[model samples]
Target: MKLSPTYRMPLKRRREGKTNYKKRLALLKSGKPRLVVRKSLRYIRAQIVEFDPKGDKTIVGVLSKELKKYGWNYSFKNLPAAYLTGLLVGKKALERGIKEAVLDIGLHRATKGAKVFVVAKGAIDAGLKVPLGEGILPSEERIRGEHIANYLEKFKNIKEDFEKIKQKILGEMNG
Candidate 1:
């Protein structure tokens, strides 16, 4: 018995679990830039990306580490840092005249109040119009870093630091 040799291979990205073509297609169909938020164990990054035939162009990219420029002195991967990064990206996007975008979390699960959503909340606060469902963002206390502050003695002032950094980001962007 001879077996057929007409097997088709899947896309490389799919095999590598990187890109979800179906999701990408849906997002592209909306005709809006994508606010892509991704997180690693030690960092969070957000980008305003526009789809292109050749490749995706990142209009604005912000990393949690960039928060240091705004006076953030805590963990870069924390919830507050994610929010600040989002704010920075949103401001940058607005400066480039991108008024609206859609959230693209990629293959990450849509966990309620996750750091990714915190980033989205921050972007929303920064005047970028990214459509997000209600109740997906974290609570005010969490976003303010009160929870982290209360969790450790050394982090007692995290909430205050968060506010100061947040103000600095907004002020610089507005000015």
Candidate 2:
């Protein structure tokens, strides 16, 4: 009896559920840098990456934890933190001469007004051109940490802190 030929195995990242080749191929086809946003339980990270024949090269990268340098003292995985990280990465990318990028939310669901989109909105606010549809961003109030402020008494100062950190990032970017 003839047996079928040995089946090929998927790439390690694909088998481990870390990479999606189809989506990645589409993003690469756009011929723009990728704004890669990834989140964990306690942190968020944003990077501007360019495709290379040998491997991907990161143009700029920022972690939510880096917000501490800008005086952010809240949860690093929250919406506001994601935005700040995005903004930071965006500004850094701009400084590196990258003006636009395509969003690459790997394996993340495309939820409207979600943290990922909030990051995209922040990048946009930082003057990075990323193509997004209408109404994809969270409302301004949410991005400002007003929701957290309204949810708890101790967070009453979150909005003020958010504004301060935002200004600091922008100020440092310009100066």
Candidate 3:
């Protein structure tokens, strides 16, 4: 008897559980700390979580919305924005005495050159170690500066896209 296409795959493979559970288990076993990233259309967030499996505990958290006061308005959706978010989270973590952590990329595939990697780079730049590759080393102002630099570099390609976003933000600010 032949099984259906979906059934041919194991339960874990059929669902997204395999990768997610693997990441969670790895984070739990590493015993170091977990830097988890979650993103959305308007904002991005990162947190340092300690898995207790029996209690409520969150080491630290940083939200992009909160960084807007520092001039990080969400008018851009590029590597630079991601970099800024990472920088903020890393800086906050460092202030809380978190120097090292394990990246828990839940439900997300680990791609070499991706936005998540770029965020990790920003965190590394801010002095957080992730034991995966060479870390990024950045100063406190690195995020804002790098965001500007990246925007300038890709001005030609992203000008049109960012212009619309900028206009919308400006309108909101004015109204």
Candidate 4:
């Protein structure tokens, strides 16, 4: 260990590259539940969480892997799966009486039409009042997996799969 008075000790998570204290502070100050969205190489996950002095409490959570239960046959890490996972999380949050939330994208870059925003879009459509910019979110058609479906046209079997899944997601959101 480098023992020097000039050396400042960083927090454990900060050293581990897991937590961003600055961003977390800002989200906590919003006084709204946070819609935490995360994605891996193979799956996406979304959670509606509340801040607690002791620890963050998850109110509702959904994973793209859960899409299999709804008959999703595509990769769980795709854009459509991210949207559906967000929709599922939003529906559950609403059922728990959570009407609004601020998005917590963590260390992810905020790119235009990123998967995080797609999840936010799904949550918005599910009736959660999360603030979003028109320019950042993907188009309505894209959220319905049109972009994906178009790209998979040659593979007839899976070409329409996402559209069907989007319909099922919408149906679940409605009833």
Candidate with the greatest lDDT versus the true structure? 2
For candidate 4, lDDT tens digit of each residue in 53-153?
99999999998999999888777877777888888888888889999999999999999889999899888878899999989987776666666667776
Quote the lDDT for 14 in model 1.
99
Model 3 lDDT, full chain set: 0.63
Worst ten in a row by lDDT for model 4: 154-163
lDDT of 3 by residue, 2-62 (tens): 5666445556653755455555676788888888877678766778888786952678887
Best candidate, TM-score-wise?
Answer: 1
| Candidate 2 lDDT tens digits, 88-130 | 9888988999999999999999988888888888898898999
Q: Which stretches of candidate 3 lie over 4 Å from their true place?
A: 1-19, 74-76, 134-175
Q: Rank the candidate models, highest TM-score first.
A: 1, 2, 4, 3
Better of 2 and 3 by lDDT: 2
CA lDDT of every candidate: 0.90, 0.91, 0.63, 0.85
Please give the RMSD to the true structure for each candidate, in Å.
Answer: 1.5, 1.5, 8.9, 2.6
Question: Which stretches of model 2 miss by more than 4 angstroms?
Answer: 1-9
Query: Model 1, range 30-111, lDDT digits (tens) per residue?
Result: 9999999998888899999998999999989988988888788899998888888988998899899999999999989998
